[model samples]
Target: MLGKLLKHEFKETWKLPVLVCVLVFAVFLATYWYLGNIPPAASEDEISMAAMMAFLLFTIAVICGNFALLIYLAVRFYKNLYTDEGYLMHTLPVTPRSLILSKLILSSSWMILISFEIFFTIFPVMERFFQLLSTDPQISLYTALGEYISISEFVLLVVVSVIISSISSMLTIYASISLGQLFGKHKVLASVLCYIGFSAITQIITSIFMTPYMVSYVITLDTTTAAAASFQFWEFFRTILWIGVGISAILAVLCYILTEYIMKKCLNLD
Candidate 1:
């Protein structure tokens, strides 16, 4: 039953994600073609300027496209599960948990997919820019990545963080929309307000909890104390990563419970 719900949800929601990816890929290819053709005889300064401008434009497009996709997903979730269409959803022979899980899984998958698409799509442009700088054109992506940290650990951390963050974000929106259902009128407006309120509260709580550790970490690096002291950067980063994961996991669970309770017990379909 859960599988069927997921299949249906994916089928309905895939079009937008696919469309966004296609458009982003098209832009990336066009930009790459235009920029990669710059003649070697062009002044180095001029080439540098053009490369920077092209990178900026490509980055802006990717960011905007990703944000638009997220907004579309959130709107779809609200419309499909909270609007008049919800009348059909609630009547389906499925548990509230299953339905919510289906949406969560699909939304998180799309978010992760879009994130990867944005990264890989722009990678060629970045590679070309590096080449123009007379840097090692043979540099592997992993070699560039190694300058930061252990690639495997960092990649794992990133994947986990993205998944958890996506789930947390979608669940927050779901919970907000569920709360808005309590209103008898202007439910969409109410949902928007709830989302803002929830985001503010979450931000405040996160700042209170995470700011100290982050500040301490920054101070250590800024003063060069980390080098003098027996500080392990990887250990510190891993701790922070796990802390964030824990917080996101807890929030995701709470939002899931809230959404499930509302849909099952207090759904306002009128």
Candidate 2:
């Protein structure tokens, strides 16, 4: 039953995800080509302006793409399970738990997919761009970043971070929307307000929790101990990363439970 639901959801939602991926690739490739083709004698203003425009487009493409996908997930969930279509959906043989699980699984998968696309699509092009900008034949992408960790470890940690954060965010929205459905009217508005509140609380909590670790890393001494400082920074960063990952993972589970409970016991698809 969950399998069928996932299949149906994927069939309906694939277009936007694919389009976003295409747009990201196109934007990155266009930026790469433009940089490589810049005239040898181009003015500083010209180069800077062009590069800035490219970067701005790249930023917009990545951000808007993911934002659109996230909103689409919420819209589909609401329409399919809480609106007119929900009448038919509820008549299906599956339980509300399966319905919610299908949504979460699919949503998390798409979130991870978009994160992967953004990281890989921009990395190689940006790597070459940096090397060209510096005119250093030996300048590799790993030159600065490899100081504290191997590329594999860096990539692994990045993927782990993305997965945890993405699922946490999606589940938070799902839980917010589920809770909002209980409202007698203006459910969408209620959902938006709930989301804003959730975001605020989350930000405050995460900040409070991370403050000690952050301060410990920041209060250390001066420039004479550059290497030591860098090591301290890395330790600080690792601690922060793990802390964030832990918090996000816990939140994701709680939100999943909240969403499922709402779907199962408090659902008011009016």
Candidate 3:
């Protein structure tokens, strides 16, 4: 049942992400081809530096465009989840658990895919740019990725961040809409009000608790110079792991309960 639900959800949500991927690829190809044949008057190192800077600028532009598309996708998903379509959606043979599961899984999966698409989409442009500047047979063609930064950890962080952030955002929307629908004859306004209310409550709670919580976590870590020198990468991961996982679990359960409540108790399809 969850699988079937996800299949339909994927069908509905895939278009925008796929189109973004295509556009990113096209941009990369165009940049690569244009820069490849254009001989620069500058020395090899200068040309390399210029090409790298150009790639960075282009990347920033693409990321900004990707963010806009992400906003559109989020709005579309929210509308599909909240409006009359949800009535028809909930009427299916599947339970609320399955429906919620589908949305979470599908949306999270796309988030991960988008993360990868962003990486691979830029690789060709970068690769070609590097090749154009390579002048020596001794100089290996493989890019010095490590020189910039340790990308493995960064990549994992990005993937987890995207999935967690997307799901969390969706949960807020679902909870707001659910709370809103409880008010008769003012469902839309109710939703907006609920969202604002939720935001205020969240901010208050976070403000009151965030500092103490972070301080406590910091205290547990080694403060001594010796311990500080011995700090491990896993330490950072462990610190954030529980918080991220806990928030994910909390939001998942909240989305489920609120969605179920809305479906069973408050939903009035027009």
Candidate 4:
């Protein structure tokens, strides 16, 4: 039953994310083209500077596509399971847990796919882009990044961050939309408010608790030695990264339970 739900959900949701991925790759190709055509004196030209700004916007667009995908799916969840259609859906033999699991798994999978997409889509162009501006012959992405951390560590960080953040985000959205079920009218507005409230709360948590601790660790690092400072800074960065990951995991679980409990208690077919 879970397998069937996953397949159905994927078929329904795949088109938009797939289209977003295609558009991201299209933007990447344009970036690659611009990088390949740069003349030695191009950096001096105002037109080239404008093009660089456009390139950065293109990279930002690639990332924004991920958010857009999540937003669309969030809406889909609310409409399918909490709106007029939900009565039929709830009548199905599938358990609510399985239904939620299917959506979570698919959302996380697409996010991971697009995370790697953004990384690889931009990675090949990074070396060329930096080399065009950098004076050092030894300047490569690996060497530049190696100053702070090893290439392996950076990759691991990206992967871990992607996985944890995606799941956390999906569960948050699910929980927020689920919360709307408790409201009698203007459920959509209620969901939006719930999402905003959750965002604010999480921001407060990081601002008040996690970020200060991370900043304190970085500020306390020994400054006499440049090498040691870099190591310690990134080490603290990783420490904060894991702490954030733990918080996200906790948030995800809480949201999951919140969603299930709300569905069981307050779900209204009327």
Candidate 5:
């Protein structure tokens, strides 16, 4: 049952992300071709000029493309949340838990795809732009690629952080709507206001708690001696990273549970 639910969820969620990823790749390839085709000029500064133009174009593509993709994803999510289609969803033979799990899984997968599209597909092009700007040819693209790959651990951690953040954001919206609809009237306005208020409060609390750990981490990012003393820099980072991953996983589970509760208890589509 869960497998069937997931199949449908993935089918529903896939098209937009795949399209966005493909568009980003196409833009990148076009930009790469444009850069490669530029004629030799008196000053190699022309290379930098071409690279800068490509960078700007790629940035615009990312911004506009990601915005459209996210908007589509959000519209689809909300539309599926409340409608006759949602009624069919609710009446599925599978339990509400399976339904919520399916959505959560789909959401997380899409977020991962978005991250991969942004980083893997786009960053290499930006790296090429940077490579063109650099002085030494022996300071080759391989060097840049190696440096980027060496920090893959940090990149993966950051990706996980982003996925968790996105899940939390969507869960908060879900919770706000659930809370609002519990009221008989003014549900939309109430939801908006509650979302704002809750977000403010949550941000304040999170800042207070995270500040110390963040300060310590920032200090560690700089502490070459400390990095050498115990674990290597990567190992030191990994220790903190596993802790973060654990917290993120726990929060994701709780968010899914919260969404499921709302779907089963407070959601009123009629």
Candidate 6:
């Protein structure tokens, strides 16, 4: 039953992400070709200006597209489970828990997909542009990034961070929307307020929780000492990554529980 629900949700929601991905890739390809074809004699200033413009445009589009995807997912959850359509949805034999889980899974997957697309798509283009600008034959972006840490460990940490953070964020939005359904009217407005309130609270809590670790990290970064031992830096950062993963997992679980309870008990489709 949950599988069927997820399939239906994916079918309904896939078009938006597909369209976004196509548009972004098209723009990136066009920009990459244009930048690549710039004449050898083109002045440094001209090349720099063109590259900067392209970078800014692509960056803005990627950022906007990612936000739009998240907003769409949030809106879809609210409409499917809290508005008129929810009447039909609730009549299904599926449990509220199943419905919420399906939505969370799909939403988080889409967020992770977009994050990867942004990273993979923009990174190579930017890397090439910088390489061309510097004309440094030995420059390898990937190698430079992996210099301070084990590549496998860094990649594992990144993947975990992205998945956990995306799930946490999606669940936060879901919880907010569920809470908003309690309002008799102006539910949309209520949802927006709830999102803002949740975000602010989360930021405050994260800041407080991370401050001590951050302070300790800074204190350890004596250039002379750090230069003598780079492994210490990797260990410190790995510890930070684990801390973030733990926090995010806890938050995601809490938000999931909150959303599930609200959907099952306080659901107001009135």
Ranking by lDDT: 6, 4, 2, 1, 5, 3
How do the residues 102-167 of candidate 1 rate in per-residue lDDT, one tens digit apiece?
Answer: 998999888888887877777788777666655445756556557556778877887888888888
| Whole-model alpha-carbon lDDT for candidate 2 | 0.81
Candidate 1 lDDT trough over 10 residues, lowest sum: 38-47
Ordering by TM-score: 2, 4, 6, 1, 5, 3
TM per candidate comes to 0.83, 0.91, 0.60, 0.89, 0.72, 0.89
Q: Which stretches of candidate 6 lie over 4 Å from their true place?
A: 39-47, 225-239
- Model 4, residue 121: displacement in angstroms? 2.1
Whole-model lDDT values for every prediction: 0.81, 0.81, 0.65, 0.81, 0.66, 0.82
How much is the lDDT of residue 222 in candidate 2?
Answer: 43
The top-ranked prediction according to TM-score is 2
Model 4 compared with the native: what TM-score? Answer: 0.89
Q: How many angstroms is residue 52 displaced in model 1 relative to the true structure, after the best TM-score fit?
A: 2.5
Q: Best candidate, lDDT-wise?
A: 6
Expressed as tens digits, the lDDT of each residue in 1-270 for candidate 5 is 999988887876787778888888898788877766654344555456766777898889987887776556545555676546887887778787786667666765666666667777666675556556655545555454344335676577777777776676556555665566566787767877877886787656556555666676657565456535334444545655556555555655665676678777777876
Clashing pairs for predicted structure model 2, backbone only: none
| Residue pairs in collision within model 5 | none
Worst 10 residues of 4 by lDDT: 39-48
**Candidate 4 lDDT over residue span 1-270, tens digit each:** 999999899998999989988988888888878776774234433245644665687778886897898888888888889777787789999888987898899988888888889888787677767766655546788675688877887888888888988899999999988887778888788988999999899878866667677678767878998888878877887777877787788888999999988777777755
lDDT of 3 by residue, 43-148 (tens): 5555656676668876886886577665665465456656767667767888766766677676656655666777666666766666667664244323344333
At residue 39, candidate 2 shows an lDDT of 39
Candidate 1: C-alpha lDDT: 0.81
lDDT of 6 at 105: 89
Model 2 TM-score relative to the real fold: 0.91
User: For candidate 2, lDDT tens digit of each residue in 1-270?
Assistant: 999998998898888878877887788788778867643323323334555566668778888988998998889888888899999888899998888888888888988999898888777666656654554457777676688767787787898999999899888998888888999998999999999998888778889999987776667634467777776677778778878888899888988899888888887767
Q: After superposition, how far is residue 238 of candidate 4 from its true place, in Å?
A: 1.7
